[model samples]
Target: MLWRRRAGMNGESDLAIHGATPGENIDESVRALACARHLPQPHLDRWLAMNERSRAAFLEIAQTLRLRTGQITAALELLEEISVRDATDCADILAAPEIARIRLHAGSAPARARELIETLRARRFPRLRETSTRLAGAIRELRLPRGISVVLPRELRSDVLTITVEVARVAELDGAIEALAARRAAIARIIEMLGGSE
Candidate 1:
């Protein structure tokens, strides 16, 4: 599972699993970030101390910059266009055939170009998602030697919870339960910090 940082309303951010079959490490990172966001100072410090890469990814997700309203509106329009077009149509649009004719009719607007690119990206997202899902499934189904486990760590403030699985091979069914357990633990800590419970 690849961890994807998605922009949220009001300049907030959230995490998403890029593939249908999620990875333990990706789940751990998502949980750790959510936990640290509400944890007290010392606990947060300890959480960051667990791993540098984890800290960086957390910060990057937390610090997502907001786009201007105009940019957002343009992006929305692009999304609409993407929704109506098939993959082949999208490719055709991007091929830049009859560039001179297009240039003559479209005029020279940077915003228009940006919008076109955005539309292309929006159209491609579903395809990307499908491909990622297939790859993740393949990875999950791979067989590995015994005694090796994939460790995923979820951190919150000064606490770190790790999910470890002992499996004979890297089959699709392996490690998911342990990873989900760790994720739940991390979420529980985060909720507690948010005044729910310990």
Candidate 2:
């Protein structure tokens, strides 16, 4: 019956019963140990033996609890870093709206608009490369298009070459923003669970 009761307590309950609630329990247990110092050796030995299985179970539970807690903490820290980086990227995008607007404006002369578009494309190349690399790695195991082409001006005309690369670039930027938002949300949830905040 004692063994059955011990088994029913599982591991976490044993730790709780051992008074491992934080700082108070440790000090309490220390005082208890000092008082027990005067007890007979045989009685102490038998008591420890009787609690051996409970101790083992509690140790296992403590290890797992610490490991999971550490993992969650690390993950939250990483997400915070990602959120900051993503916010910086978003700020860059926000500051560069003029570039995309210039590319989209139909009244802008083709040569001038083309120059602005080319500049925007060059500026975005590094970010696009990073995003594409991640996407490529994710899709490597599946069969998909190796590359996609978008028509400029979105209108088909042999004489008038109207193709805006900015559209695709903007889409990629939006996707990156969305990805960051999702990561931030996930991090927020973990932080809430761990009793932290943004």
- Residue 23 of candidate 2: its Cα lDDT? 37
- Per-residue CA lDDT of model 2 for 114-194, tens digit only, reads 444344344445554444344334333222222322121211112222212222577775654554454454433433322
Off by over 4 Å in 1: 1-80, 83-123, 143-198
RMSD (CA, angstroms), candidate 2: 26.4
State in Å the error of residue 176, model 2.
Answer: 23
Candidate 2 residue pairs in backbone clash: 152-162, 152-163, 152-164, 153-162
Per-residue lDDT of model 1, residues 23-51, tens digit only? 35544553455454444445444334433
What TM-score would every model get versus the actual structure?
Answer: 0.19, 0.15
Q: Give the TM-score of candidate 2.
A: 0.15
| Candidate that would win on TM-score | 1
lDDT of 2: 0.34
